[model samples]
Structure formats: C-alpha cells, structure tokens
Target: MKPNASSVSVVRSVTRSAIRDVTRHLRGVGLRAAPLALALTFAASGGLRSAHAQSAQTAPAGQPSKAARDEAATRFKKGIDLFKETDYAAALVEFRRAYELAPTWQVLYNIGQVQFQLQDYAGALPTLERYLSEGGRQVPAARRTEVEADIQTLKGRIAFLDVTVNVADADIAVDDTTVGTSPLSKPVTVNAGRRRVAVSREGYTPQSRVVEVASGDTVKASFDLVERGANAASTAGSSGDTGSGDSSVPQTGTGSTSGGSGDSGSNVPWIGWGVTGGLAAGAVVFGVLALGASSDLQDLRGTRGVAASDLQDASSKATTMSVVCDALTGAALIAGGISLYFTLRTPPSDSAASAPRTRPSQATRAPRATWSSASRPQSSGPELQIGISPRGAQVIGSF
Candidate 1:
C-alpha cells in the first residue's frame, strides 16, 4: 500500500535516528571491551599479530596498545608468583620471558631478585645495576633502595685471599680444612679475619703461618718451608767453618801435597837412559878434545924430545879436559837421581794438611844439592896452596 509523502518521510526519519542511536551504543560497547576483544581477535589471528602487538607495547611509551600492555602485566605477575615461591630456577625463565615481552623496569627488577635468591650474585649484580642505570625513573624509591643495599651486601661478602706458597704443588689447609694444592691460580674466599694456614709437601718440612684478612680486602701471605733434613745439616756443618781468622786454605785434586824429599829408587831404566845420553855426549866431546891434544902433543914429542915447557902445557890441557868430562859425568848422575826420585815417590792418599811429611820443601832439597856438584869441578893441584873464601873454594898450584 503506497503511503502519503509526509508519512513516508516521517517514517524514514525515525528509522535513520534509530539506526544512529544503535550504532552509538555498539561503539560504546566496543570501547568498553576493546583490550580483551582485541586480544581475543589477536589470538584468533595465528598468534603472530599478538606477538607484534606485544613487541610494540614493549617499545617506548607512545607505541603500546592497551591489549599488549595487559598481556605483559599478566606475564610479569606470573613471574612474581614463581619468585615468591622460592622457585628461582623456574622464576628466572618466567622473568626473562616477561622481560622480553615488555622490557619494563619491574620485569628487570624481578630478574635480579630471582637471580639473587638463586645465589647468582654475579649475574644479578649486572642486571640490577643496568636497570638502575637505564630505567631508574620507573622503579619505586623503596625498591631502588633495597636493591642498592643488596648490591652493597653482596659486594662485601665477596672476599678474596691472595695465597702464596714457597713450594709448588704443596697441600694447603685453611683453618684446618684442606683447600687445594698450590700454587693456586686465583684467590679463594673465607670468612674475613685471622685464618690458620698450613702448607705441606712430601720430603719437606710442614710450615704454618697465621694471616689476617679484612672484609672486602685481598690479603697475601707467602710461606717458605725449609727442607726436612737441610736445616740441621747446614747448622752442624757451618759450625766448624765460621770464615774466621787463620783458617787453613782448602786445596783440590791430586797434586796439592807439599814435600821436600820424594822416594827415589824406582824406574831405573828411563833414568839410566837419560844418564847414558848425557855421559855419551860428554864422552864424545872430551874424546874429540883429547884426540886433538894427543895429536898436538905427539907432534911436539916427535919434533922435540920432551921439553919441560911442552910437557907442562900438554899436562895442563889434559887436566882441563878431564875436569870438564868429570863434570859432565856428574851431571848425568844427578839427572838420573832426580828422575828416579819423582818416579819412586808414592802419591799421598790423604789431604795435604793431614799428611805432614808429604810437603814440597822436603821433596826438592836432595835434587838441588846434587845439581850444584854437577855444575862445578875441582882442578888438579900439586903446590898445596889453598884459599878458603866466602865467595868460593880455590886452589893455586905450581906443577
């Protein structure tokens, strides 16, 4: 049924107003449920959209959606619950996940708190310190103070002891408890103050020294343990030899003895050869001179019959040759004596000081006396006039 123009227009206007009112009501409802609804929508979109939204929320303040913020808060609360239960191992995983999701100051604080509970002070220290450095303004004042105090306490408790031992690989004990073998590569920690340290090694004397360690301070103590038998022997050996006045000088090896007289009856063959060589050279020279003199005397005897002048001259020349020959023969005998003396001498078995008779002065006296006689010979004399002088013995003769 076709309506009139006014009625149709009024009806159309009512319908449009009603539609506008309905649309406004739906907008209100969407605003009220936006975060949860968007989260549900994100979940329906294969979880990638939700991750992107969450990442965006973890960005600086202007970037995050309400839904992403709520999700981060939920994860952070879950980590807190785990931490409260003292499940630090599991709590660390949860806190790390939340930190990745949001990167908020509170999440980082939770991570440090869990690490501290787990006795991971080294890890916790850096994390808390970083949070204070980067996101300090976001952390509550009370919590910041607490974390700072915790850091100080941990620092105090972390002590170091620089232990040095004189001997390597010796067993070390601290406060009567065996710690390790030296030399230690790094310092170890114990409750600060006086500690009893003992070092020991096989075949070495055990040594101990007391060391005092201060809180947060590294103390070094070095120990020198003496060898077991060394001290006693050193003390006893050094007592007699004090490096004082008039100590006898020490000598070394086989030739250190001193003696004047040596044994002289052995190795006759070599001595005889030396003597024979000297005597033979002397005999040859003297024989040559005697032959020349005999020839001259014979010529004179042949030419003139035994004049006193010629006879006297011939005798004098013969005597001089004879004396020279005798001197050579004596020298041969003395050399033989010296060679024999050294050969027959028995080497002293004891040290020179202990063998009083085996001294140098006694060894050389006989050889020197024998050599003096070989160097000089007496001339024949008949006048019987002799002069004894301080310089030497002399004889004057008229033949």
Candidate 2:
C-alpha cells in the first residue's frame, strides 16, 4: 500500500503550488502569514525533502541579507565608539553612515548636536531649522533654545545688504569692485569707512557716490545716474565754461576758456532746454509702463490653469519692462535736476550772439528720442518674438 517515488513527488509538487497560491493571496490582503504557512507545510512533510524549510532555516523571514545587516552593525559600533571617545567629527561620519542605512530622528539630532559643539553655527542652523520645520512633538525645548541662540549669534556677525539702486541691472560696486546688481534688499558689509560706491549700466552714464559705513551699522546710499543726454549737458557745462579764450570752444584739455563765451552761451541754452523736455516725456512714459506692468502682474496672480509657459513669459517680460522703465526714468530726472541748477546760475547770452548756433540743439534731440523710445512699451508681437531668444531678452538698449 506504500506510495512509489513518482507518486510521492507528484503529491509534494501539488502541495508546494498550493502553498505559493495561499502565500500570494495573503500578501494581497496585507497579511504576514507566508512564513507560518510554509513552516506548517514543511513540518507536515516530515521536516525533510522540502525546499521551503531549508531556505527558511538558512535565512529567517523578514530579516535583511547577511551582508547588509553586518554593514549596519559595523557602522553603529563605530558611531558608538566615537561618541564614547568624544571625537565628534569622526562620530559624525559614522553616525551619518548609520542614518543612510536607516533614517531616524535620533541620528539627525546627534549630527546637529555635534555641529553645535564644533561652533559651526551656520551649518547647524539649517539642520536645526529642518528639525523644527518637521513639526514633530518630540523635539525638546532645551535643544530648541540652544539652536535659536546659535542662529541669533551668527546673524549678529553676518553682513547682509539692503541695497537700493535707482537702475535695475546696474552693477553695484563697493570699494571699486562689483558686488551685485542694484535693487538688492539686504545689508551688505564692507570695511567700515567711506567706501566708494559706483553703479554702472550699459547705455547710461555711470554714477558714483561715497558711503560712510560704521561698525555694526547699515549704510544706505543710492546711485542717481544722469541719462546720456543730461550727462552730455553737464559735461559740456563744466568743461566749456573755463575762462580761457578757448574754453567755450570745447577744448580737449582741462583748462578754462572765455573767448568763445558768446558761442558757448548760445549753444547751451537750447540744448539744456531740449534735455529737460525729453526727460519729462520719458518720466511720463515710464509711469504709464509701470502701471501697465502692475496691472498685468495682478491679473496673472489671480488667473488659474494658465499654461506654465505663458505665465513664465508674462512674468519675465513684466519684470524686465518694469526695471528698464524705472531706471531710465530715474536717470532722466537726475539729469534734469542738474541741468536746471546750472541753467539758473549761468548768465544768459545776448540775442545777437545766440542767433548763429543751431546744430547742438539737433544733436541733443536724437539721444532724447532714443531714451523716450526705450521707455515706451514694446509692441506685443515683436517683443514676444525677441523674448523667445537669449539675445533678445538681454537687449539692454531697448530694455
């Protein structure tokens, strides 16, 4: 009545298949009964000639591979040893390895503690911030206090910038070296003294000013650059009025001249007046453009489900236009003020002397038109076409 070897083999195969199906079903149900099912099946099979029992005995259920477990244990041991020896730096390396193997808040806390002990307050600030930001109720109050104090101390020594440049994209130079672009909002530190500040942008005259910085105090200074036309006027006035006979003839040297006084007076009057009128026009254009950009930005903010590409394009164009208009407008105003000041102080020429000069007026008007054109809002089609390319967006002249 004993079964033959082939018959017994067939029965064992059927049992193994049934066990696999049940294991899969349990797993689908989120149950952890595969190991127990395999154990019972093997025990019923006389604890021999069963592959599942042999595998289970060799590698226990739910346990990681031997190599991984060994590596983790080694890292944990090294971390504990370093912590005992008070070698925080070495400990941090080992602890970090353990954290990578298995992430836990305890490991992060240890890292933060070591960073604090090493006086790397800047590095510790972010880690502590992350811990706080996680919103875990387990973070201790004392640890929070320590991290906060460290951050506050670092902030005191850190130099920040609250830069306000009249021109956007204008390079802000501190002590003759460029630091950042204008319209920066933070406090930046320089050697506490009368530091030379310069703001420079293409198509506009460079403006320089002196800022006296005190220790632990933020210095505020802004560049009020003169537009090209206004700058030309100021240069002409300052250089052309020298008492020397050739001064009114725009001498190449730095000497004063008085001989061409009549000619200089005649040329200066209209050029100055044209520069003033152009600048005022530019101001009006800039104001209009600013209001339009603000309205567009507000509209974009309220809109939903707009294509990402369109939103990005609108935002970038609005920002660029806003900056360019404001900068140009500011430069024009500065130039206008300087021109007005000089016009009032200088003596007027007689009508007979003024009648001959007419070319300077025409020359000054071209730059004014260029400035006004730059301040005007761009046509949508051409501007969008240009904005698609890198060079187009960087066109500072037409910005």
Best by lDDT: 1
Q: Estimate every model's Cα lDDT from 0 to 1.
A: 0.59, 0.55
- The count of backbone overlaps in candidate 2 is 16
Residue-level lDDT tens digits of model 2 in 1-399: 344587568757755764565456546544333322432243224322332234334545654444444454467556545654557689678756755654444455555555665555444556556655663666567656655675566545333235676668888887677777877756565544566777888878887777765545676676676679878888888776654445355423222323455456556647766876787687677778777877787788789977778778778877876777766666565555444443443232354234443454552342221224554333332221111233222111211
Ten-residue region with minimum lDDT total, candidate 1: 31-40
Error of 1 at 112 (Å): 1.4
Candidate 2's displacement at residue 377, Å, is 75
Error of 2 at 362 (Å): 36
In model 1, the runs with Cα more than 4 Å from the true position are 1-75, 159-399
The TM-scores of all predictions, comma-separated, are: 0.26, 0.26
CA deviation > 4 Å runs, candidate 2:
1-143, 159-162, 173-181, 185-198, 205-216, 237-399
